[model samples]
Target: MTISNHASVPETIALPPKEFSRTLYAYVVWGGLALALLWSWAPAEMDRVTYLFSDSGNMVEYASGFLTPNFHDWDYYVQEMILTVQIALWGTVLSIFFGIPFAILSSSNVAPIWIVQPVRRLMDACRAINELVFAVLFVVAVGLGPFAGVMALFVHNLGIIAKLFSEAVEAIDPYPVEGIRATGASKLQEIIYGIIPQVAPLWISFSLYRFETNVRSATVLGVVGAGGIGQILFESIRGFYYGETAAILIIVVITVTVVDLLSQQLRKLAI
Candidate 1:
C-alpha cells in the first residue's frame, strides 16, 4: 500500500528535469560577450595583474603623503565649500521649477500622447548628457564661474526630477482625479486640486535627494573652471599638494555625509 501511494504521488507531482546543457550554453554566451567587451575597450598595453604588482610600491609611497592631512588652509577651503553649496542650492531650485511642468506634460495619464512624447524625449536628451559636458558648454557660453555650474546642474537634474515626478504622478490614485472631473473642474483645476496634493511629498523628497546629489556634482564642476573648491582641489593635485587635496576631500566628505543624513531624515518624516 505504501509503495503504491508513493508511486501515485510521483505521477501527481511530476517536475521538469534540470537542463544543465542549456545553462552551460547560457554561461558560455555570457562569457564570450564579456571577453568581446574587454578586447574591444581595454588599454592595449594594460596587463591587469602584472601592473598592480609591479607599480604597487610607488602607488603606496605616493598615497602615504595623504595620510597626514593638513588643514592649514581651512578658512579658504570653507569659503569655497560655501560657494559649492550655494551653486547646488540654486541648481536644485531651478530643476524643481523647470521639472514640474515638464513632468506633468510627460505623464501619460495627465497629458495627450503628443505632449508626452516630445517632453519625454527632451528629458531623455537632457539626461543623456552628463553634468560635466553641460558644464563645459555653459562655461564656454557664459564664460566660467558658478553660473555655468548652476546651469549644468539645473539641466541635468531637471531631467532626473522630471522622470521621477512623472512616475509619481502616474502612480497616483485615480479616484480623486475622477471626483474633481465630476464637479466640472477644468483640466488645470483637476491637476491642481487632485494630483498635486497626492504627489507633493514625494516631489519634495525627490528634490531634496537630488539636492544632496548636486552638492557632490557641483564640487567636480569647478574643475572645469565653473568655480568652487574643485578648482583648488584640481590645482592642488596638479601641483602634488597631496596634503591639501586630502584636506579638501575630507571637507567634502563631511559636508556630503551631513547633507545625506539630513535628507534621509526629512524623507522619513515627510513620507
Candidate 2:
C-alpha cells in the first residue's frame, strides 16, 4: 500500500464570480454612502467642535453651579420629586395591566396571525414615538398635569412591556406547554398553567426595570408641561435659578439612586 501525504494539503475554495461581484458591489455602495454623508456633514461638524472648544470656560462656569446645590425651596423640590415617583408608579402599573394582554396577543405561539400582526404593529407604532412626544400630545389634549405624564408613560411603556413579555412567552420551554395541552386544558388554561408560570418572574423583573426608567422619564415629561420634577428643573434653568436647579438636581439624583438600589435588590430576590 502506498502512503499518500495528502493530510498536509490545504484546500482552497474560490468565490463564485456572482457572489464575489455582489459582495464587492455591496461594499462599494456602503462605502460611497458613508463617504457622501461624511462629506456633507464634515464642515458643520468641524464648526461645532471648534465652537465648543473655543468657549470651554463658559461650559465650566455653568457646570460649577451644581457643586453647591442650593436647597432654598426644599419643600417644593421634595413635593415635586414625590409627585414624579407617583406618576412613574401609576404609569408602570397601568402599562403592565394593558401590556399583558397585548403581549399575549402579540406572541406567535399564543395567538393567531391575524391578532398577532395587528397587535405587534400597534406596539411598533407606540414604541416608535418617544415618551416626550406622547407627553406633548397628551398635554395638548388634557391641558397639562401629572395625568398627561402618566398617560404618556403608560402608552410608551405598554409598547415596550408588550414586546418584552411577548419575547418571554415565545422563549418558554415547550415541555410544560405540551403537557398542559395534552391534559385537555383550554387555550387560556394552557397559557395560565404553563406559560404564565414560566414568564412571570421575567415579567416582574421587566416591570421593575421599566418603573425605574419611568421615574426618570417622569421628570422629563414635567419639562414639557406634564407636571413633575422636570417642570421645576426646566423653570429653574429658564429663569436662571442656578441654586434651585442645583437643589432639584441633587434631589433627583438621590431619589433615582435609592430607587435603583431597591429595584436591584428586589430583582435579585425575585430571580
Candidate 3:
C-alpha cells in the first residue's frame, strides 16, 4: 500500500479510427436519394397537392351521393361477384401449376446460371406489364369475356408466384440438401425429398395470398369488358348511376374483406 502498487496500474487505451469510407458511403446514398426526389417532383406533378384542399367541397358533394346506396339490384350484383371469384380461382390455379416449374428453374440454387438468367428475365417481362394491359390484349385475341381476365391474371401471377417460390427455395437450409447428396441421391431426388418439403409451407402461403390479390385484380379486369362485377360497376359510373355504383362498390369491399380474412387464416395454418 505504501508503495502505491504502481506496477498494477492499467494503461489508458486509444479508440479505433473512424471509418471514412462508411461515412462517405452514407453521404453518397443520401445525396442520391435527395437528387432522385428532386428530379421526380416536377414530373410527378406534386405541386398540385394543394388542389385536394382547394376542391374539398366538390369531393364532399360527390361523396354524399355514395352515402345512400341502392340495393335494388343486389341479386344481380351477387351473381357477378361470384363470377369474378370464379375467374380469380381459375387464374390462381393455372398460375400455381405453371409457377412451380418456372420457380424451380429460376432458382439459382436449383438450376444452372444460364437457365436461371433467362427464366428470371422472362419472368421480369411478364411482371413488367400490368394485368390490365394483358387483359386488353387477350380480349383482342380471345374476344371479350372472363377468359381474358383469367389469362391476364394467370400470366401476371405466374411471374410473381415463381419469384416468391424461388426465393423460398434459395433460403432453405443447405445441410439437408448436402446430406441427401452424400447418400448418392440424384439431384432430382434431393430436391424432391429435401427441398420440396422445406419450401412447401411457404409455397402454399404464397399461393393463398396471390389468390386473394387475383380476386381484386379480376374485379378491375371487367372494366375493359373482360367480364365481372367491374363491368356492371363501370356501366353504373358511365350512366351516372351513383347509387348503384355505391352499392356495387360496397359488395366488392365486403367480398374482398371476406377473402382476405380467409386467406390470412389459411396462411397462418400453412405456416
Candidate 4:
C-alpha cells in the first residue's frame, strides 16, 4: 500500500513550459523591426553632426595622440580646479540647508494638503530644467566663469535635495510621529524631536550622492565654457591637441572615482 501511494507521485507543473519560449522569439522579431527602422530612418540629428566614422583616419590619429600627454601647464589647472571644487562643495551645503525644510513641508505625514500639494509642484518645476541649461543662461547673463556655475549648481541641487529629502521623510516610522502627537507635542516639536532624527542620516547620505553627481556635472558645464577641465578639453578637441585632451580625461576619471568612493563609504556609514 505504501509503495502504491509512493508510485502515484504528485504531478508538478513545469515552471517554464514550451509556450514561454515563444516570448523570446517575439523579442527577436521586435528587435529586428527596431533595427530595421533605425537603419532606414537616418535620423536628422545624425545628419547635422560631423560624424567621425566618415573620416576614419582622422579619428584614429586623434585617438592615438590622446594616449600621450604633456602636463607642463599643470599649474594653471590647479587654480581653475579649486574653483570647481568650491562650486560643488558650496552647492551641496546650500542645497541641504534649505532643502530639508521643503522636504518636511512636502511630505504628507508632516504637512497638510494645502502645503504638500503646492510644495511638491514647486519642487517638480525646479527639477524640470537641467543644471546645464541653467549654466548656459547664466553664462550669457553673468559672463563666462565659476560664478555662473555656482548659481546653476545651487538651483539644480536645491530641487534634487528637496525631492530626495521628501522621499526620506515619507519613508520614516509613522508610529513615532503619531506617538509624539498623542503626547501633546506641537507639530514643530514632534518633527524636531521625533521625525528629524530618524531620517537625518539618510538626508546626509543623499547630499553626499548629490555632491558626487555635481562634481561630474561641473566638469561638463565647463565644456559649454562655464569653467573647469572641460574648457581645456574643448580647446584640445578644437585645436586637434588630442594629447592634452587625454590628460584632462584621465584627471576627470580620477576626480569622479575618488568622489564616488568617498560617497560610498559615507553611504555605508549612514546605513
lDDT of each: 0.93, 0.92, 0.94, 0.82
Local accuracy of candidate 2 as per-residue lDDT tens digits, 1-271 = 5476665644887765677788999999999999988897866675477767688999888888777788878998999999999999999999999999999999999899999999999999999999999999999999889999999999999999999999999999989999999999998999999999999899989999999999988988888999889998998999987888989988999999999999999999998
TM-scores, each model vs. reference: 0.87, 0.85, 0.89, 0.81
Worst-scoring 10-residue span by lDDT in model 1: 2-11
* Better structure of 2 and 3 per TM-score: 3
lDDT of 1 by residue, 1-271 (tens): 3657443454376678879999999999999999987896657655566877689999898999899888999999999999999999999999999999999999999999999999999999999999999999999999989999999999998999899999999999999899999999999999999999999998989989899999999999989999788999999999999999999999999999998999999998888
Let me know the TM-score candidate 2 reaches against the reference structure: 0.85
Q: How many backbone collisions does model 1 have? A: 0
Candidate of highest lDDT? 3
User: Candidate 4, residues 1-271: lDDT per residue as tens digits?
Assistant: 3667555666885565567679889989999999988786676455645676878898888678977876766666656666677778877788789888888899987899899999988888777889899889889989998878877888887888888999988899989888988999998989998888999888878888899888888887787777776677778779977777777777778778988998899888877
- Residue 41, candidate 4: Cα error in Å is 5.4
RMSD of 4: 4.3
Clashing pairs in 4: none
Q: What alpha-carbon RMSD in Å does predicted model 3 have with respect to the real structure?
A: 3.5
Model 3 residue 20 lDDT? Answer: 100
